[model samples]
Target: MKILITGGAGFVGSALAIALKQNYPHYQVLALDNLKRRGSELNLSRLKAAGVEFTHGDIRSKEDFDALPAVDAVIEASAEPSVLAGLDGTPDYLINTNLFGTVNCLNYALKHKANFIFLSTSRVYPIKTIETLNFVEEATRFALSDEQPVPGVSAKGIAENFPLDGARSLYGTTKLASELLIQEYNEFYGLRTVINRCGVLTGPWQMGKVDQGVMVLWIAKHYFQQQLGYFGYGGTGKQIRDMLHVADLYRLIDWQLHHLDQVNGEILNVGGGLESSASLQELTQVCQEVTGHTIPIKAVAETRTADIRLYVTDNTKVTNLTGWKPEIGIRRIVEDITAWLAENEKDLAPILK
Candidate 1:
């Protein structure tokens, strides 16, 4: 089987490419990326060493896909993933990449008759709805109350059926719009597709920042002894998020590829679930324990317009269908990142710090 992963040089895309090639030596895995992310170029060497072919290309241009050979599947992983992407009043790049880029990838898949898998975001759920969910503030974190005002949400987390009426962020609107387009493609073009509405995905190789990849950003700050902050919810650091190790995501994608007929046209919520969730305050404790560094974290009571108080994936539907659950816990995830940073300290210090 042959696979094309858009944004293949990125942390998630590159990791998936390497894992697929390593597990299926005979399979051809090609990674096409523009290397727009700060640390993405670093993965080119890794991809080459893993016997994965790398192509320099942008998803925004249809001509870029023309240069690549036909494949059995396309994993649409490229995106301007920041939630605060267009708040600066410039949204052209984000819209073109996340929406139009996805259309280009879909066209490529359509031409090749390839299976499509979209990496959608939990942010597609409206922030207004999520922020209003009932929660209890514990000493360290905010816990979702069992009784929510909305359906498809519970103490376990938000599920796929959560209402999508309100406005998500600009970043999320693009993804949600892409999801709709993919569905249309599947219905009209007979395309086999699977959509994974993923929550915070973190592991090694992620170039995390404050706007996204917060799990890794938190660890990076502690590992590098950088000052951190609790920005919202009265600055108590109680906002909660569940994060999945990227490896776990790879496992699900692998299963979906093998069973596309079963999962096609299915939109599943994927994440670490409640068991793997942590609040920023809890994350700080873990980071301190892992890095053995104690740093003062500033408190800012003001919340970002795009920020949500809590988001945990309700993975029940996916787990029930595929029997797949995240094996790596929050602590293990932190430990793995710490180890990655330590081993690559010389190379990563400038980038991560």
Candidate 2:
């Protein structure tokens, strides 16, 4: 069976492709990417080395999908993964890629009778709702107490059934909108599909930026001894987030692909869950532990308008369905990134800077 991974050269996509090739060498895995993301080009070499075929194509263009061979499965992993995406300017690129891009991918999926797997974002939960959740700020992070059960959250974190009503930011809206579209295709057209509303995914080869990829960015900043900043929410650096290593994501995807029949047409919250959750303050401690370097950090009371103080995936639904759980914790994530950077420092330092 051949699998097509959109955003194939991306951190998640590439990692999935490599794992597929290694575990199931007999099966063909092709990676289709626009290579538009700045650091995605670097993965071209890695993809080649993994024996995963690479094609340069954008999901925004229908022609790209039409030109590709029909595959049994398509993992729509492409996105403009930043909450502050459109806040800085027009959300054209984010809209075009995350929204229209999914349409194009779904169209391709329907045409081929292929299974569609969408890597949606945890940000799809409304910002107003998330920010309003009851919180207990500790020395390092904000957490939900057991007393008040948040509408969309629990001690397990944000679940799939959580309220999605308010403004979830433009980047989130696009993914949520795409999830709706994927559902339509599944119900109306009988296309087999699974939607994973994922939280912050990290690991090696992730080109983490300021607005997105906070985990990797934090690790890199500390390892390189670069300056970092904490913004908003009193700038205590206590805002929290759960993280999933991209490798753990790949394992879950593999399970979903093999069990498409049992899990079709379901939306699941997938992430590191409570065990892998961390606040920026806690992350700072982990980075220092991993890199043995104190990162220079500045703080400000003014925060990004679209930023959420905390988010963690409940992952209960997916776990019940597939027995999939994030195997790596925050320390392991930092350690992995730390090792990756140390090995590829000569080549990665410039882009990271």
- Please give, for residues 194-239, the per-residue lDDT of candidate 1 as tens digits: 9999999999999999888888889999999989999988999999
Q: What is the TM-score of each candidate against the true structure?
A: 0.99, 0.98
Compose the digit string of candidate 2's lDDT tens values, residues 145-263.
Answer: 65554565776688888887889889999999999999999999999999999899999999989888888889999988889999999889999889999989999999999999889
Best candidate per lDDT, number?
1
Local accuracy by lDDT, each model: 0.94, 0.90
List candidate 2 stretches off by more than 4 Å. none
- Give every collision pair in model 1: none
Candidate 2 Cα lDDT to native: 0.90
Per-prediction backbone clash count = 0, 0
- Top-scoring candidate (TM-score): 1
